[model samples]
Target chain A: MTTVLHSRLLNDVLRDILSPYDLPPVEDVTTRRQLARTLLSGQDNGSFNGLALAYAVVAFCTSTEDGATEVLAAVGDNADVLVLDGVRGGYLLLPCAQDQHVGLARALHDRLGSDVWMAVAWASRRDLASARATAEDVLRIASCRAPGVYELRNVLADFAVLRQPHVAERLARMIEPVVAQQPLLDSLRAFISEDGNRAAAARRLDIHRSTLDHRLRLVERLTGCRPTSPRALLTLSVALTAHSTPQVPLPRAY
Target chain B: MGRGQPVLFDVGRLLHEEFLAVYRAAAADADGWEDAAVSVARRVGSRLISAKVPVAQVVVALRSTDRLLTEAMLDDGGDARALAAAGTALAAELMSAFCAGDDDGLADALLAGSAPDGAAAVYTVALVRGALADRVVNAFRRHGPVLLATSGHLLLPVPEAAALPLCRDVCAELGGEVWFSVAERPAARVALARKEVDEIDALVTSLGRPPGVYRIDDMLFESAVLDTPEVRDELDKVVAPLLANPVLVQTVLALLEADGNRAVAVRKLFIHRSTIDYRLWQIEQLTGLSPVNPRDLALLGTAIGLSRTNALG
Candidate 1:
């Protein structure tokens, strides 16, 4: 507790930094704060302390309109960690152990019947400045994970743990590729689905498999390839999970 | 005015817009007392919109009450009759809303109607009283929607309909602007206004409420093949008229039921030959229908059955 970044300080700093993005007025922030406080205050009731770990904070919710209203409905039950990541066209807040974010992502996908991204805290450094340095390291592993899925999570978390400027620059880079590649990847995914198999992918594409293969080869073949070795499948999986756009997998035979 | 689309309202936006709306409505009023009312309306409207229910129709209901107040304040002749007329109109609107569906609009309506200065408030009283009396009441039966906008009330439409002129008329008197929002929504009828009631100094103004309220059972029975547009149009032309001469229509129906046998249906209807024949002629002229075609005969039978059935009952 002594070595770790202080909660009050971190809360103050993050609240200040994110102040500009708060468009619904300070009232919304106030309401959220009050709600968090109320939830935290009922520690004796066990509902509040039941959800959080000793040094961790967690808040999560599900938009019940997705035809799966029952998932995570019980107020008392909660996962060890909580974070938000993009899913389908919107976003979802996920909860589980940092280790279980992967499983929770899978469960969320199952419940909502959609792919979703997960951003877990790999580490929480003392200062925002130092946290940003740590984020740069994790984000470099960005190629192995879905692009913006964890970067924003990492930046937000790191900024939560440490008040460094690095979170912003790194987050800016993280969101740029996601926003850019979204449409291209979206089109490519549709083409793959409609094409059925990769062989069919070529015939309908009016191109040889070699051309299509060359494109896929590039996803793993690039020089700064975080997803290059043993990580190619992992990277593609994260990308697909972050968004429901299924990758044109190497089609297996019957 | 731009297009027939409802102003999108979530809880946050609804509250914001409602407050803004109240601010504007209060500002629009040359008189300042209505600001308090506008404030309440703003709050309630915000909550309803956040719940994401279609309550645009509610605006009009409140405005109707406001218009009545304005008209009364004009100190015009028959002011009592005008206010009474407004009350009936508001009542009728609330009744229509309740009868049409399970009321998700009640909270906003109750809050708005709680005020007592104007027509909207009075209508709310009428509406609450009416809803309490008959659970399965008609549309616009309850009165709260009108009271919310009793002060400087403008005839603002909710669903895709033209607002009542009374709202604009009263608004004019109060030096307020009547901003009518006509949303081009698909579910409701277009440009449809509330029922008209001729004033009789509060002595039971018969609100010519919408005539098409069909209960579930009524709809189910009307689901017969004759309800098809082709058959329905024919009946609307033919059957709507014969509701007058029950004996004549019945005799004609009996004759048709008996396959146009003058002898057998005469016994069926206990009518004279010439009487049946005369009614048959009227039926032919009105329906443009001959008893000869099988389709026309089936249509007649079905229409007669449906028309004779008490829809409200």
Candidate 2:
């Protein structure tokens, strides 16, 4: 069994745990003090006892308000859990069996249906110091993918591979020289997609095989990469994906 | 002071919520309990100001909180006069913070393109003839426009259906030429709309077109050509021979702008109708494409549009 509290409620409980009455002055004293003040003025006046408030993964969350509460209540009713309150949503603090939590998340998803987007994070109880960081990381990774229960390890690896700085810079440096030549760029994209098949790429571009070959030659001269090479093909394919993909903006700040 | 009673009530309600939380801390044996309440008040004041709640409404909310705190103190058998003095002091601190927050919110709104979220269309106004920017802006606001940003290029959020009528009214009111474009898209997409607006405005300016509501969607082909440099370059090459002669370029441009109406081109250029017809024939002889034919007119219009608008991207 483990002890955990809701992540959002941490900002509130942090005030009480790190108040001037409870702890010595620390490095982020000003920020702690501000939080403590906000907590004092907030409407949550409930008290806590006995349970050790530690970190836990948010296995799933929904967008709607009542749906979230119903799911939280249902999860609490079925399992030995604490349904902690959050300002915008609720969190489930599971004390035992991580599988039981995942099971509950799945059952909740079934109930909420596919319309609502759910999120999950990779967090551990022992990593209390990095709880907020873990939660934010999961949220960022989740934003890039579709709505579902996200497994953090795989998502993190995928994100790291796709977003490596040098990979992006190399792709851009090669593709920048051909951006203005729409027809050549289109042909290059088709050729890369068809696995460097000249016949297939020509059909896709609706051009003659000779025309496609000529375009490939021009592309090689422009980007300094041969389309026929496997390693070069992967880079070109990934480059086209990166070029065409629209970057979703972060959520607006108040 | 500019806020209504409902807004004041909203401020009071939110302040009360925060006050209860502060009261809980103060009632406990926590150190800095009194300072905590002051901090809470300041934070709440700042939030109200940032939300664009009026200063007077914030003052009313603070006063209401003070009254509630005073009543609670008396109920707890605290000295009434002492509580009153502390309440007055707290009120003064909160009011000062609230005013400071109001100023900060104004600055932030100016820096960010802060507006109500339901803005459906984006309008960019580029004032050309006179210093009538304020008058044009006030008219848009009167018709429920949310001013997103202003840097000479005024970005506003307006409804799509209301855009043309509103633009027509403003153009009539100002009584002078001002370049404008309306992009009937979501407000969040205004960055793209800004580019479209700039292109349309540039197109109007280069054509020496009179003040009117120019929808960005009207010049769909021209806009596409403008965004693609290679396509524009090709079109420029196609029209290069005619462009070499400034008079012929002007004649084709005038004819295209007049929508192939020779009489209209004649009137616009202050030349005889026969001269326009002769120029059209000369244009055909030079390029092997007559402006009088529908298919040839479109091709010629695109080429001329590319050559005429040097300001296009």
Q: Per-residue alpha-carbon lDDT of model 2 for B20-117, expressed as tens digits?
A: 65554443434565676677666665555435465665667778877887678667766665565456545665665554432223223432444332
Q: What share of the true interface contacts does each candidate keep?
A: 0.00, 0.00
In model 2, where do residues sit more than 4 Å from their true spots?
A: A1-254, B1-131, B148-150, B155-157, B184-188, B228-230, B311-313
* Accuracy of chain B in candidate 2 (TM-score): 0.57
How accurate locally is residue B14 in candidate 1, as Cα lDDT from 0 to 100? Answer: 35
Tell me, by TM-score, which candidate is best.
2
Question: What's the TM-score of chain B for every model shown?
Answer: 0.26, 0.57
- Name the 10 consecutive residues with the lowest summed lDDT in model 1 chain B: B194-203
lDDT of 1: 0.33
TM-score of each: 0.19, 0.36
Number of the predicted model whose lDDT against the real structure is largest: 2
| Cα lDDT, model 1, residue A100 | 40
